[model samples]
Target: MIEVDEVCKSFTVRRRSGRLRRSRTLVGAVDRISFTVAAGEFVGYLGPNGAGKSTTIKMLTGILTPTSGRVRVSGLDPSRQRTALARRIGVVFGQRTTLWWDLPLRDSLTLVRHLYRVERSTHQARLAELTELLELGAFLDTPVRQLSLGQRMRGDLAAALVHDPELLVLDEPTIGLDVISKATVRAFLTRLNTERGTTILLTTHDLGDVERLCRRVMVIDHGRLAYDGSLPRLRAALDADRILIVDLARAAPPIEVDGARVVRTDGPRQWLAIPPSGNAAAVVAAVAARHEVEDISLREPGIEDLITRLYGGGVPADR
Candidate 1:
């Protein structure tokens, strides 16, 4: 669905050398990086601000031409075949809106229908489906400027999908949204990917978003590809441990379990730390067979924790 090969983007900034003299320096926002996304895949692209995440997205969307390397979406060069690429891809940037501020949601979508040259009947049907799927009925007639942050985001999602684009590039799709709103967006996206097979490339500061939506993640640091693989592999690479908390029927001696070590014992409850690469379900079943289990909960390594460890002492840049 997407291919980026040794893509690099840089910028030149000028600073006053003394009082009148100026010096120009070239800063590379994205170093040589390579990755590919297969169709129907939901991949997360993560990096701190100024780590070239935006630059990469812009290059993929044809908003900016890369200084070096190649970028393709759906087999077309995004920079050279922008018009064709646009028709196959939908983009949603949470901090910015593409909808007209003064227009009602319905009006904005009407414009989109015309802009995309969608058949009236097809547009109508898709609009209705999107409206219901995104729960935008109440605000269909409400102006974009009048809707709450959450409502506006739902509208954005619907707007992106109205054309039924094969690919979606979402930048912080859940930003500023409340818990319910976030869940709504996540569930909708999950269904879209699973049922419709829309390829999604999500970039978010919220690790929770990646945790819920992405199985494969690409981590970028200092404009370099730090990691690219499944979330489980990423965690395993961090050498962290998975914790299992078990509640027993009664307080007993520290339960010695194979493949796991007791890290904490609080009354009848005990905390066991299993190797990050270990089989958690097997450990759980083994312990349960020996003790009367009242409750069990597992805490996988937190995404944010792992990411922080991955980018030690790197301050988040405001790109």
Candidate 2:
């Protein structure tokens, strides 16, 4: 539902030089990045600070026009057809709320319905559904400014979806939320994609969000597309390793395993590094056979590690 071709965005900024002298320097935020998102697909877009993620999202959402190349959303040019595109897409910014701070949650949603010109009956039905799914009934009459962070976020999600847009673009939808709140948001998004068939483009710093909600992931670094594929392939491309944390019944030295090596230890707990090709079950069984294991857990390589690898040099040749 989204397409970008050879897109580039640049800006000119003046910097003070010696004394009263100044210099105008050109900066590239997004550099010839091209990608596509099919209808009903949930994709994760990731990057660190100043990585051009926000710039790309702004261009896609029509907030900013690119300096070069073309961008299309739902087959419409975002820059020229933004007014029409707004009707087909929903955007949620975690740091800010779209609702009116002084108005009750219901009233704020009502305003959105009116602004979108949705029929009264349709708006009621949609609001009812959102209220149930997002559990907004408790604070439906509460002022936005009075609600907790989680409540405000849930209310924002309802406001974004009140018009039934075809695509949803979320920027850190679960930021600063508690674990339960994050889970609720994730579950709702999963249903929105699977049952409602609403396409999703998620940009988040939380790897947990991507790991739980997205199947296909994209990594951008230094204003360029570094990788785009399934998470499994991403790990394989980087030869990423997983950590196995084993808790023994008593303190002991590092346990030796054929496919894994000890990377850290604390009392009876030990961390073992398993290669991408290593079988975690086999390693666990080996460790259990030799050591008195009380508990065990596995941790996949974090997104930060992959991003660090990519930024350390250039994109991986295999990717």
lDDT of 1 by residue, 137-241 (tens): 899999999999999999998888878999999988888999999998999999999999999999999878998899889888889888888887777677778
Best candidate, TM-score: 2
The top-ranked prediction according to lDDT is 2
Compose the digit string of candidate 2's lDDT tens values, residues 233-287: 7777787789999999999988999999999999999999999889999999999
Model 1 misplacement above 4 A: 242-299, 312-319
Q: Distance from true position, residue 298, model 2, in Å?
A: 2.2
lDDT of predicted model 1: 0.89
Query: What local distance difference test score does each model get?
Result: 0.89, 0.92
Model 2, residue pairs in steric clash? none
The residue pairs found clashing in candidate 1 are: none
Q: Which stretch of 10 consecutive residues in model 2 shows the poorest summed lDDT?
A: 310-319
- Report RMSD for candidate 1: 5.3
The CA lDDT at 311 in model 1 is 92
